[model samples]
Target: MYTTKIGLAPAIHDSFIASEPLGHLLQSSKWQEIKDNWNSEIIGFFDDDQLVASVSILIRPLPLGFTMLYLPRGIAMDYENTALLDYIFEALKKYGKSQKAIFIKFDPAIQNLPENEKVIQKLKNLGAKWMGLTAEMHDTIQPRFNAVVYKADFDEEKFNKKTRQALRKARNSHTIVKFGRDELLDDFSEMIQKTEHRKGISLRNRDYFEKLVDTYQADANITMVYLDLKALLIEAQTMFDQAQKAFETKETTNEKKIKQLENACSKAKKDLSVLTDLVQANGDIVAVSSALTVNFGTHTEHLYAGTDTDYQKYYTAYLAWFESIQYMFDRGAETVNMGGLENSLLETDGLLKFKKNFNPKIEEYVGEFDIPVSRLLYPIVNKLYMMRKTRI
Candidate 1:
């Protein structure tokens, strides 16, 4: 028998933690720290002898003692199993009722493969209400995807003249691409701040970005493009990590320790080799973007991409994107998601227009779905929050 329960404490789901499908972006220590510090409840589903899946729902208080649950890139489980899904949701419903939560929310990490339309339908059939337009991306923990998913096989013939031209231009441009851990984060922070300010949006504080970099540095890819003489222009990141497997440092003094040390040395040597390659470049960075790749057995998401506007004329940002697409293809990725579209459908959205140029077949994602516990109070609280946002 499988058991489901609710509690503030972290679940003892070591097995799921060892092999659950999610990226480091969702599993970063900083994100976890933030969740833990905030009011949260762990919804764990367990098999007789093992904890199979779990979702951590972080709650925020609302007026009149109401609360809302945010399932941040959550619902860790076997989505193909309807029985498990129902079991999990039932547990959540019971728990929400007990907590007197206003509503429950989740945005599952389903990919665009097998078509996103089907996934949306499934969610509705499973008793989850769709909160946003099916065609428009929603405001949720994860960005709603309008991605380009490619097959595993490579097709050189599919490369159009424009794509080739972009690649050629990037190679011919006197620029260097650099990759590192936290070495360039402080430098990148300046670039991020500049871009955010231009977009009339506030960015994560310097400390938050630093903590993010530090937490995911082990597996994150920090990519930057520099022009002649290493002038920063584009700083795109292809951050990724295996969330299913985490290294558990063991206390040992024998062959195990020796092997662990050897592995660390080998990794350092390999990383240095790559760094050496980056240092040899001599171009100033003009535009850069970063993405987190989350793998879920049969799907993956190229999550989040931001660029610099200071050098938009030079089109360094295009070059960076071209390089990233090629990199994803080369890495045997089944689909290279260009990511979601925000305010792009508007006629004046230039960034959205640029992404559409990649010839991506745009589709909507299953956005935030809420299971309301207190139907009466949930709407009132939600309206107040929306009103506040609108005023801002």
Candidate 2:
């Protein structure tokens, strides 16, 4: 009643994935182009002549000629269809055996909802080992928790007060957001490098970033936020002048108003001084923040982003991120994924705190699963993989 097809063409594979509700950019065939280090294949399951399911698998060579098969956020199919699920696993096992794959690992993009308990159990029933619900960032290959902003009429007024204030400050400071492809890559890369050094974590290099833009083509964008120091300086000076005049002309015996005027004058003076110094050191304009995003199907993902710490007060990152989201939506993307977050969802986490400003709904996935092909080698290979992962 069912048949399997290997090496499905990119367009055909992408079409099937785009048609599914759980479709993700990771499952797109173009992602294989980004993960060039891994040998990849697109496998499709069909009922007669109609394609029912598909997964883009990445194969990595392991020790002693064994291989590991990974389907990142994959198996773009209806999980409720029991028969299709069984047949697909069986087909994958047979294919894995042919390639001496130790096991096939996958972490579907399905959210961990109450109704999905049956799907998890069904995976176990098929002899796939469920990696427990991990709450840490490094506990799994892909993050188990993601922050997402679902599509609606875009409204800035709906944002929290702090976020709105930040956006206002960014605008008042004369920050400009520009979106492009390869042209902005250099600025984007520099910001990411600064972030890497500040956070003490390694991220993708320039070459990898280049590959992403090149492979994804029109769907990918690099957004850069630039600050016009000259304009900011003028604005700060104007504010300082107004505040100074207000303080001097205050006929009111209200000490509170006098104090407010004094504070405003002092803050404006400080900002003006800082902007002058920055202009002297950098230039009239400087790139303060940058982000990379990719749109696929109905969703857009904010992949990697960074900000120059020196210009932190300018809040350019906020403008960059918000503009990128707007840009993606303008291009017809329905959902914008803010990417991964730590599972704990603690307010103390700086990344979570920053992403929460946008008020995203946190999605917890069903974690990873391993379908062992060579039961004898799976345990050993998995152990080694885990150790290597931790070191990285």
Q: Which candidate leads in TM-score? A: 2
Backbone clash count for every predicted candidate, in the order shown: 25, 0
Q: Model 2 residue 171 lDDT? A: 86
Give TM-scores for every candidate, taking all chains together and pairing residue i with residue i. 0.67, 0.93
Estimate every model's Cα lDDT from 0 to 1: 0.57, 0.89
Candidate 2 minimal-lDDT segment of 10 residues:
149-158
What's the CA error at residue 290 for candidate 2, in Å? Answer: 1.6
Write the residue-wise lDDT of candidate 1 on 1-392 in tens digits.
Answer: 87975542442532354256542234322356545556766666777856777776677776667667777766667767777777777788778877678788877655546565766676678777776654433345566656565653234346566655665665565656665546766555665676677788876655765555565444344556655424211121111111111223444568876676667555555544443454465233333434333332233345434566644434566666655555655555555666766734664677566665565656554567777677687677667755675565
Q: Report the C-alpha lDDT of model 2 over 1-392, residue by residue, as the tens digit.
A: 89998988889989988878989899999999998899999998899999999999999988788898999998778988999999999999999998899999999998899999999999999999999898578889899998898768356888989999999998887888898988888888999999999999999889999999999999999999999888888887898889888888889888898888889889888988888898899899889999899988989989999999898887888898888888898898988999898888888999988888776789899899999999998898889878888787
Q: Looking at model 1, which ten-residue stretch has the lowest summed lDDT?
A: 236-245
TM-score of model 2 relative to the true fold? 0.93
Stretches of candidate 1 off by over 4 Å are: 5-30, 34-37, 50-52, 78-82, 110-128, 132-141, 148-157, 229-310, 324-336, 343-349, 356-361, 385-392
